[model samples]
Target: MAASARIFSSANFNSHVKNVRFQLPCRNRQRLHLRSRQRVSKLSLGSPNQRFLSLTSFANFSPAQFSVSGGCLDRIFFGTKENSCNWNFAPTRISDGPHGGLFDDEKGPEVTVVVLGWLGSKPKHLRRYVEMYNSKGIHAVTFVASVTDVLWFDLGKKLEERIENLAQELAEWLSNSSNGRDRFLMFHTFSNTGWLAYGSILVNLRDRKDLMEKIKGCVVDSGGDPNLDPKVWAAGFTTALLKKNSSAIYPSPDKSTGPQSGNMENGLKTEPKETFSIEPWMLSTFEKLFSYLLNLPFAKEKLLRIVSCLSTDQPHCPQLYLYSSGDKVIPFQAIESFMEQQRRAGKEVWCFNFGPSPHVDHYRTFPDVYTSKLDSFLKKCLSSVASPMPS
Candidate 1:
């Protein structure tokens, strides 16, 4: 990472941590990755899809059964669904001091950047981004959904209600915090899980034109797959189940040995080295199982609604997509096709292909390049706030 990129590093991360503190409920000691493996093994005893559907549909599945890794996971999985405290990845905060770059008084619009994290991502997974935005003097509110939320997104109403509550909070914040000066909202999403949650927020805000006008742009990172294809769903779910590490099952592009030892900003360890390979048959089986689960009538309908909302209900704002040809989870063609569609609809769009970065890990791999592109896009979006860009 270059010196410019290091501007958004551990220092800002710690600053935010100290400012926003929440004492969450006690968590279970058992690690979720271990339990997930055991659950997968148990599924082999019966039809995988049938077993999964039974678990999701039955109200009898205990909190212990769906347990995740830390106190954050316990709060998210077992806490009251409608409580805003349990759902957001981090509490919202405004820029506490002056910033130097694009957001200087006359140069850019005052902006609030809402960052949505990928599926199964913990708060630690999103720390870098919070640092990135907050260091830029931009307010950031980070959010992530549990695997259970994504798995049953449309089948149940809890996630929808939580999203609505989030939207309401954003609306209130924009209204109250503006101080008579123009303030804007920019959405930054990671992977499909965040992208879909972004869509749900759009749905909640559709009827509120005032808040809709406050949205100046969106940045979609490692996402924009706009269909309900089971294969893609299977790939995403598989990655989540294996966890987001760059092991053999989810190796980095170019196959270089990953970082062995280094401390990232915030004292986070570098990615662990690859240790094992996953068999091809496991992916095939998961795909077959998802094909059955996703095709169920109610599930299919909910998925279609999500896809449709993203396509038709989005606000008229500039869009930027950050993705890579090297990503195994999301095919590059899907992103290109989606971008082409947006172009045809006369929407302003920008994209960056970080040639060999892994899904949602572009910043970690190429922080300089990632921050450079993002900085450029944010400048463009703010520059065009009061005027339309020429096609």
Candidate 2:
């Protein structure tokens, strides 16, 4: 068998991460409270026309931690030094590129890179990506959505309100910037959670052609499949939950019998499932229940329509999709088909299939290849812009 074929025979890492669960508060009412390690937020759903109220409180985390050495702290915290709202922006110097040096000194066009991170994505992880963009003289802003946000989407509850709020914030931040009108916009989204947020932003800006034209391109990693199987959805959700509540559900791995010694067939690593035992029947039952709920009259149709819009209604710009065949949480065939559809529609789409790397683990498995592809894509996006603006 070919490497990809042999790898298909082995069980995936989903089995190792499948046992964790978090008991959410009752969703019977229209309100939900989500408590995280550093913050607590309340969300209230109202009538269709009424505005939804969401309150989030941050504790002890400082904006200073995000500041790069030569970057302005104000620019890092606000969209610009003049803005007062708490949008997370972090400006950094690019020492070697064409737009190299401090923002005040850079000689190239200013590009604003907005990153939407996946569920349970850590601040450190997001910061790393931000730094990468900063190193290229691109002003980077990042938003990390909590696991509760994904839960809301999974239940098809108040998702619009949540996405609307984010879109408004982003729109306001960009519109108010001193140099907003001339700046090129690019988005890098990680996983389905990020894709949801990105889709909402697109929906909110559908009528704003001025803003839409400013968007140069977008890069989607490990997600954005138009159709997600219920089983795959459940597995991805389970993985996110495990990551969020890692301290409670995942015991420290025994070095002797954990990931290190696990089998690696056809370049794909399979973790030992003994650490977390989830019966196959349990997964089947969960999938059935989830499918039933999702297929409830009108609900599935409504959700599918929303997803269809996400896949087909995006702004006409270049898009790059990075996915892996060994991603157990998302079927690679779906991604391939979506790419094909985009091509058929005459949209500019590029894809790199990194075979055998687990979901979102492409960078880890093939760092050089991943970085090379990303650099090429970024250059292509920049080349399409006629002129670069001052930061």
Model 1 clash pairs are none
Candidate 2 stretches greater than 4 Å from native: 1-92, 97-108, 154-159, 244-270, 273-275, 279-282, 297-302, 386-391
> Model 1, range 1-391, lDDT digits (tens) per residue?
1011011123433332212112223322221221123111110122212212111212233324443344433444333232222223222333443323344344444577888878767666777777676666566777767665665464566566656667877787777753465778889998888898898888788888999988988999999999777777767766666654434223344634323213122222234565424424335545655655576678777767877888877778889999877677888799989988888888888998866567887777666667767877777777765332122
The global C-alpha lDDT for each of the candidates, from Candidate 1 onward, is 0.62, 0.56
Point to the candidate with the largest lDDT.
1
Pairing residues by index, what is the TM-score of model 1? 0.68
Task: State how far residue 200 of model 1 sits from its true place (Å).
Answer: 0.9
Off by over 4 Å in 1: 1-109, 244-282, 384-391
Candidate 2 residue pairs that clash: 76-89, 109-388, 109-389, 110-389
- In terms of TM-score, which candidate is strongest? 1
C-alpha lDDT of candidate 1 relative to the true structure:
0.62
